[model samples]
Target chain A: MSQKVTRRQFLNYSLMGVGSFMAAGAILPMGRFALDPLFQGEAQGSMITTSVKAEEITEEPVKVDFSYEQQDAWYKSEVTDFVWVYRDGDQIIALSPICKHLGCTVTWAGDDANPNKFFCPCHNGLYEKNGKNIPGTPPRGPLDQYEVGESDGFITIGEMFENELV
Target chain B: MLYNQKDLKVLKDEIEFIDTVIIPFAAMDMDMKAPVHAGNLELLQIVCVQLEKQFKGRLLITPPMMTVGEDTSLLGMYTTQLREYGFKNIIVLTHLQAEPGDMNKIRLNEIPLENMSDDMKMEMINDEVKTVMKSVISIWNQ
Candidate 1:
C-alpha cells in the first residue's frame, strides 16, 4: 500500500513544525536567564595563583611577588604586589609587607642594624619574624596575614586577614 | 596621602602629622622635545606614586603642576600659600632645572625608557625612586 498527503495537510504539518522551532528558540534564552545564578556560584572563588612553588618557602621570610587585575575607577590594570612568606614548622605563613604605621613596603633585614627583622626604611619601623611589631617603633599593630593554599605544587593567595600568629 | 577628596577630608585635622607636601612639576612644550617631555612626566608620575605609597602617613602629594618653560614664579606663590596652610616642607619633584625661591627641589635623572626591557625599566625606575626617597629623608632629618 502507498500513502499520499494532500496539499492542505502538508501545509498544516509544515506550519506546526516551523512554529514549534521558533517558539523553542525564544523560550530557551529566557530559561537560561532564569537559571543564571546557579552557574555563577562556581566562579566565585577568588584564589589567585602565584608563580612560586609551595616547597620553596623556608624558615626565613622571603618576598613573593604576585600580580592581579585591579579596577581603578574607569581603568583596569595589572598590579604587581609582594608579601613576606615563610614556613613555620609544617605550616605556610604569608604576611603583608605594608607597614602598620604607614603604607611603606617593608623588607627582610632592610636596616643593617636589624638583621633578623622586617624593616621599613621610612621612619625605621621594625617587625619580628612572626610579624609582631617591636615596641617603641612607629608601627602600632602586627602585620596583616594572607590566606594561602597549595594547588598542584603551586602557591595560591586569597583574601587578607588579621595576623593570627601574633 | 594625596590631593583627592578623601585624603583632603582627613588632611584638614591631621596637618601636623602630614606636614610635608610634594609638588610634581613638569613641562608640556609642544615642540620637538614633546616626546621627551612626555616620557619624563610619565617617569615623574611613577616616582611620585611610589613615594606616596612609601610615605602615606607623613607626606602629601599634590596634583602634577604643568608649565610651559622654566618659569616657576607661580610655584613660589603656591609654596607661600602651602606654608600658610601649615605645611613645614614643600619639596618640588621634577626632571627639569627649577629654582623656586627657598623651596627644596629634587631633580630626577632622565632615563631613556623606550629602548629598555620591562625588567630593566623597572630596575632603573626603582633606582631613581630610591635616590629620590633618600633625598626626601635627608630633608626631613634636617
Candidate 2:
C-alpha cells in the first residue's frame, strides 16, 4: 500500500512556486505595457522633395536634397530640415546622409582608394554609394528609406519609420 | 556641437579660450538614405557623442530636442525650454522639405545667417570648434 499525501503538505510545498508564477504573469505585461508609449513616441513623419526632374531619375540611385516639417512629440514641436534624396526610377526616395553608426552627416566624402566606398570622417563608418552599411563598419543597419510620391513632373519624398517611414 | 579632430585643433590652435558655447538645435542633414542623417535615435547618439567631444571640458549641449517631437499644442513646452536656456542661444531654423509626412529624415540645417548678429554668425563658422570643446563638456555632464 502507498502512503497517502496530505492536502496541507501539498499546499506548503507548492505555495511559493504558484505564487511566484502568478506574480510574474501579473508583472511582465504591466512592464511592457507601460513602456509602449516610449516606443510610440520615437519620431514622426516629414516631407522632402527632389530637384531631380522626373525624366532625369535614371536606373541608378542618386542622392537629392529636400526639406519639410518635423513633428516632435516629446516636447511638442515643429521643426524642419533638408534631407538627401535618392532616386530609383519614378520612385524618388531620400535617405539621411548621416552615418548610422554615430549620427555624423556623411557628406559626399567621395570614394576610398582600395575599397572605393564612402567613409564617415567621424568614426570611419562606411557605406556603399547606394547607402548600404558596409560590413565591419560601425553602422549596423541599412540606411533609412523614404516614401516617394510624384506629382506632375516633380518628385516628392517622405520620412521612413520602422519599415515604412510614412 | 559637432566636429572632427581638425575642429578641436583649430579651436586650440586659434581660440584657445571659449566661454559661451552655442549649440545650434538643428539637424545638419536630414534628407538622406543613411541612418546617421535620418534623425532617429542614432542621430541623437551621434550628436551627443560629438557634443561630448567638442565640449568635453565646459559646455552645455542641449538634449536632442526635435521641433517635431511634440505636437503643436505643446509648443509652449519647447518655448519654455528655450527660455529656460536663457534664449541667448538662438535657433538656426531651416526650411522644410516637401512630403514631410512620408519621410523622417528630410530635415536639413539651413542656418538663417541674416537673422543672426555678427557675433552669432561667427559662432557658426567655428561651430566645429565649439563642437570639439563641447564634446569634453558633454562627457563630464553625463
Candidate 3:
C-alpha cells in the first residue's frame, strides 16, 4: 500500500533543503576563493600605456613615465617605469632609463656640456644617442631597449630587452 | 657586489678593474640593550645595501667591520690589506666617526642616521652614494 505524506515530514524535508541551499550559498564563494589560483593561467607580460605620441617625439628623446599593475604571487601593486622614446626617421625607439653600470636611472641631456647623450649622474656614466655605452665610462654594456608599438596616435611599450640596441 | 661567494666567483679573476672597496663600520656597544644594538646593525645593513646597489660593478662591499669598544686600529690594518690587494679606493663608511687621516690610508665619511625617518635616511643615503661615486670616478680618471 502507498503511504500518505505527513505534514511534519514534508516540512522537515523542505526545511532541510532550504538550510542546505543557504549553507552552500555561504560556502561556495569561500571555496572558489581558496581554489582560484589553480584555475589561473601563467603570468603574462603586458604592454603598458605611456603619455607619449609618435608624432610628438623628435630626435631628442623625451622622458616618458608610466606605471603598470604588477602582480606578485598573492600581492598586487602598481610599479612605475620610465623610458627614453624618440623618433628615428619613421621608426620609434624606446630605451630603458636604467643604467647598465649599476641599475641607476639615466637622464637625457642631463649634462650641460654633453647635451645630446643620456647621462647617469650616479657614476658619470654616458650613453650615445643609439643607447650604446660610451667607451671609457663605467657602464659595461648599452642601455636596454623596449619593443614599441603605436595605434591610433597612442604609443605602448613592451618588455625591455637588455643590450638590444645597435 | 657583496662579499659573498656568488659575487666573488664572477669577480675573482676580474679584481683589477674592481678598484673600490666599501667597508661598513658600525660600533657595537656592549652596554647597550640588545634591541638597540640590533636596530643599529639593521640600519647599517640597509644603508650599505642601497649603496652597493648603486655602484655594484665598480664597488666591492666587504664584510662589516664591527668594534665592541673605541679601538679602530683594525680598520687601519684592513685598509692596508686592501691597498696591498690593489684597490685604489678604500672608503670607511662609519656610523661611529672615523679618524681623519691622509688620503692614502682610508677615506672616512660619517653617515649620522640616528633618529631619522626612512624617507630622510634614504635621501641621505642617495646623496652620500652620489658623492662617493664622484670621488671614485675622479680616482678612476687619475
Candidate 4:
C-alpha cells in the first residue's frame, strides 16, 4: 500500500522540528553557564599552577608563594599558599610551611643554631632536610607535603597530605 | 603561637627562645549594651589573630582575659602571672584605653560599619588590624 502524506501533516512535522531546534538553541548556553563550575571539579582539592620552576629548585629549600582562586559557593577569592620546594638528587619535594605542633609558618632556616633545618620561629620546632620532624622537638609529626606535577618546566602543587615526609 | 596544648608544650620545652607573650585583654562593660560588647570582643579577636600571624615565632598568645564589668586594674595581676611564666616582654591588647605601666598595652577600635559597604568595611578592618599589629611589633622591639 502506498502511504499518503497530507500537506497539513507535513507542515505540522516541519513546525515541530523548527520549534525544538529553537528551544535547544536558547537553552544550551544557559544550561552550560549554570553548570560550568560543577564540571570544573570540587573547589577544595584542585591543583594550582605555581611561580616555581623545576630548574630553580636546588638542594636548599626555597620558599615559593602562590595564590589560587578558592570558590565557596557564590563567593570566590584568591587564597595565598606557600611551600618549601627543593630537589633531592633526582626527586622534587614540596613541603608545606605550616608547623605540625602549631599552625605557625615554618622557615627554611629561621634559627641561627639550627641553620640547616627547617625552623619554626614560634617554638623552635625543627624539621630535617627531608621534612622529618626532629626527634625530641615540639612537633610530634612531620610537615605536610604537596602533591607535585610538572609540565612545560613549571611545577603545579596540588592537595596537601598531612604527615607526609620525604 | 597560641595557648593550646601543642603550643604550650612547645613553649615549655623551648622557653629559652621565647621572650614575648601577647595577652589579649578583652574587658566588657556588660551594662552598656549587648551589641557594643560583642563588637568590642569581635575586634579584639581580629587584632589577636593578626598579631599571631605577624609574630608567630617571637611571641605566644595567651587565651584572652575577658572580664565583664571590669577595668584595667587587673592588668597588673596579668603581668605578674605572665612574668612568672618567663615572658620578658608582655603585651596587653585591649579595647579599653589602658595605660602602659609594667606591660605594653595597645588600644584599637572596630572600623565603623555605619557608612560603608560590607565589603569595603571588611577590607578596612583588615588593613586597620594589620597596621595596629605592625605598631605593636615596633613597640615590642623597643
Candidate 5:
C-alpha cells in the first residue's frame, strides 16, 4: 500500500525552515557592523594645536609649523618635534612633511619650474595641494590628512596611524 | 748643486732619482654649489703648485678630475678615451684618513688628507709624495 503525507505536518516543517532563514538574515549584518572597526585596521595618531587665525590666512597657502606628542608604546615617551600645516578659508589640512617613502621632508614651492607641487629633495617626490601624489612620482601614496578642530580660533589636529597614511 | 760630493764612486751610485706623479682624487656625490673639494676648488689649484714646487722634478701633479659622473662613467667610451690619451703612468688609488689603529693594512694610493690645516694638508701631500717616490725610484732603478 502507498503512504500519504499529512498537509498539517508539511505546513509545520515549511514554516520552521522559513523562520530559521529569517533569523539568520537579521543577525549577520548586525554582527559585521559591530566588528568592522577592528577589521578595518586604521589607528589614530598624534598631532598638535596651532593658533593660526582663520581670517588672517588668505587663499594663498602658507607653511605653518608646530610641535606635538607621540607614544611609541607603554612606558615610552616621544615628543614629535616638527609638523607642517596648510590653511585655505574654513579648510585646514596639515601634512606631515615626512615622506611616506623613507621619512624625508617634502618641500613646498621650492622650484618655479614645477608650480604648486610639494617636492622632496631626497628623491623627486611630488604632491598636489590636496596631498595626492603626482603620477609617476616616487611617493607611492597621498599624504595623510589630520582630524581638525577649531576651538576659540585655534586649530587642533590629530593624525591617523601610520598604516592609515596611505 | 743637488748632487752631494762623495767621489762619484764605482760603476753605479747607491742612490737613484725617480719622477713621481701625485694625483689627489676626491669622490664628490653632493651638489656642486661648491668646488672640487668641499667648497674649496681654488684650494686644490693652490695645492697643486705647492706640490710641484716641493716635490720639484720628483713629482708631476695631475689636475683635479671631477667625479661628478656615476660609477658607470668608469666604463663609458669618453672615460676610456681620456684614460688612453690624457693620463700617463696612471694607477687607481683609494684610501681614507679615518683608518683604525696605529698600524693597519694601508693602501697609500687612496689615502685622504686628514683634518689638517691648509699648511698641514700640503705637508701631508709632500710626505705622500716622498713615500711614493721612494717606491717608484726603487722599482725603476731595479
Candidate 6:
C-alpha cells in the first residue's frame, strides 16, 4: 500500500520548517549580541604588556615605560606612561608615580636629601620603598599600586589599586 | 590642572596653591614656514603636557594662543588680564622671540620633529621638557 500526504499536512510541515528557520536566523544574532560583551572581555583582557623583562626588575625601583591607547571624547591617541617597578624578595611590585598630594609625577630619589625614597619634586612629597607616605610630607596617603605579572619572561601591568603593602 | 570648566571651578578656591599659569604661545602663519610653525606648535604642546604632569598641583595650563608671526602685542594685555585674575606667575611657553613685558618667557628649541623617528622625537621632546621644567623650577625657587 502507498501512502500520499494531504495538502494541509504538507503546508503545515513546510510552514513549520520555514518558520523555525526564520526564527533561528533572527534569534542567533540576538543571542550573539547578548553575549558580545563576554567575547570582547576575553579578547581584550585588562592586562597591558610592557617591554621590560621580568628578570630586569631588581631590588631598587626603576621606571618601566608602557604605552596604551587612550580615548578622549572623539580623539584617540597612543599615550606612553611609566610605573615604578621593583623586586621585593621573590615578588614583583609596581607603583604609580602620581603623587597622592596633587597628581604630580613622583621620581625615584628625585630629592637629594631623600635617598632610597620616591620623591615628588612639586612639593617635596616622599614615599618609602613600600609606598608608605612618610610623615611631614605633602602626600596624604601611600602611593597607588598596579597589578603586575610576568608573561613569557616579560612584565605585564594590569589594573591599578590602592597600595597593599602600606 | 588645565583651563577647563572643572579645573577652573577648583581653581577659584585653590588659587593660592595653583599660583602659576603656563600660556602656550604658537605662530600660525600660513606661509612657506607653515609646516615649521606646525612642528613648533606640536613640540610646545608636548612640553606643556609633560610640564603639567610634573607640576599639576601648582600649574594651570591654558589653551594654545595663536598669533600671526611674532606680533606679541596682544600678549601684554593678556598677561595683565591673567595677573589681575590672581595668578602670581605667568610664564609664556613658545618657540618665538617675544618680550611680553617683564613676565617670564621660556623660548623652546625649534627641532625638526617630522624628520626624526618616533624614539628620537620622544628623546628630543623629553630633553626640551626637562630644560623647560628646570627653568620653571628655578623661577619658583626665586
Which candidate should be chosen as best, given lDDT against the real structure? 6
Where is model 4 chain A poorest over a 10-residue stretch in terms of lDDT?
A39-48
Better of 1 and 5 by DockQ: 1
iRMS of candidate 3, Å: 3.5
Rank order by TM-score, top first?
6, 1, 3, 4, 2, 5
TM-score of each: 0.82, 0.37, 0.61, 0.55, 0.36, 0.84
- The superposed Cα distance between candidate 2 and the true structure at residue A16, in angstroms, equals 77
Give the residue spans of candidate 3 off by over 4 A: A1-44, A47-93, A97-107, A110-112, A120-125, A134-141, A148-158, A162-165, B32-43, B100-125, B131-142
DockQ of each two-chain model: 0.46, 0.04, 0.16, 0.24, 0.01, 0.62
Query: Which window of 10 residues has the lowest lDDT sum in candidate 3 chain A?
Result: A38-47
Better of 2 and 4 by DockQ: 4
List all candidate RMSDs to the true structure: 5.2, 20.1, 7.9, 8.2, 23.0, 4.6
- lDDT by residue (B1-142, candidate 2, tens digit) is 3244644444343232222233333334434522433433343344445544423322234444444432233333554554454432222212233322211122333444556798985576356334433443333233
Ranking by lDDT: 6, 1, 4, 3, 5, 2
Query: lDDT score, residue A112, model 4?
Result: 86
**Higher-TM-score candidate among 1 and 6?**
6
Query: What would the DockQ be for model 3?
Result: 0.16
lDDT (Cα, tens digit) per residue for candidate 6, span A11-108: 99999999999999999999999999999999888889999999999999999999999999999999888999999999999999999987889999
TM-score of chain B of 1: 0.97
Q: What CAPRI class is candidate 5?
A: incorrect
TM-score of model number 4: 0.55
Looking at candidate 4, what is the lDDT of residue A97?
Answer: 88
Off by over 4 Å in 2: A1-52, A56-63, A71-78, A89-91, A109-116, A161-166, B1-142
Off by over 4 Å in 6: A1-44
Clashing pairs in 1: none
Q: Where in model 5 is the C-alpha error above 4 Å?
A: A1-47, A72-78, A161-166, B1-142
